[model samples]
Target: MLLHPPSGTDRVQGLAARLGCTVAEHCEPYGKFKPAVLGSLSGLALTLKEFGGRWDRVERVYVFANWPMLEAALEYCVRNRDEARVSA
Candidate 1:
């Protein structure tokens, strides 16, 4: 998933076409954040490289493998954040 600011549909669609996949925009007034493009890792990488504004517009990009792994990662992130706060 690639999350970017709003109003990048043309760029997103063009990149998605070049990547041989379609894009699902999650812009404001309907969904959270600006937009998020979900597709293959390769396609996402290409889109990020070609049209992702050099990591400017992009707010977050998540790549999950499975439910277990995703859950584990989320747990780890939460624990890490908590530990950091405690240490601070």
Candidate 2:
């Protein structure tokens, strides 16, 4: 999952934890991107690379983020439909 949570709170993280999701923070791969958002296209690519699995084997992705992030996620899903299902 990718999240672009509102600033100055941990509410989203707390909820995700309660929902049994393990949360990890990553630095944005693009210097110009917002530091608080983890759903950028480049960020997504970096994450998948670092995750150390076959990216082509990924089956699902849930993105709770801003418009740009959502668009990028949709594009990724479209390009990898044979391997991934995305909900944003």
Candidate 3:
């Protein structure tokens, strides 16, 4: 599960812990640049990339985010629909 909770909120943290989900905390700025792109869904991509071979075996993706993040998640799923079951 990839959960991008709103900024300054910890309500989701406890739930994430209970659900055994990993929460990504990005403290970087965002824009069109590479470094900036690392804060949104791209960050999630980086996380998955870190998994190396394991990424290929991933069959499901659950995204919980808002606005642009959710938009990006949907786009990613559309592009890789055959690879996994992506839910937002």
RMSD vs true structure, all candidates:
14.7, 11.1, 11.4
Score candidate 2 by TM-score against the native.
0.27
Across residues 1-88, which tens digit of lDDT does each residue of candidate 1 receive? Answer: 3434345345545544444444443334334443343444442454344433122235333333222332343334345546878999
TM-score of 3: 0.26
- Which number leads on lDDT? 1
Q: What RMSD value applies to candidate 2? A: 11.1
User: 1-88, model 3: which lDDT tens digit per residue?
Assistant: 2235455435444333433333343322242111011112333565433322123113233333233443343344344643554553
* Highest TM-score against the true fold, candidate: 1
lDDT of 2 at 18: 36
Models ranked on lDDT: 1, 2, 3
* lDDT digits (tens) for residues 1-88 of candidate 2: 2335445435444433433342233323353222122222343455433323123213233323233443343344335643554643
Q: How many backbone clashes does candidate 1 have?
A: 0
lDDT of 2: 0.35
Segments in model 3 whose C-alpha atoms lie over 4 Å from true places: 1-7, 25-61, 67-88
| lDDT score, candidate 3 | 0.34
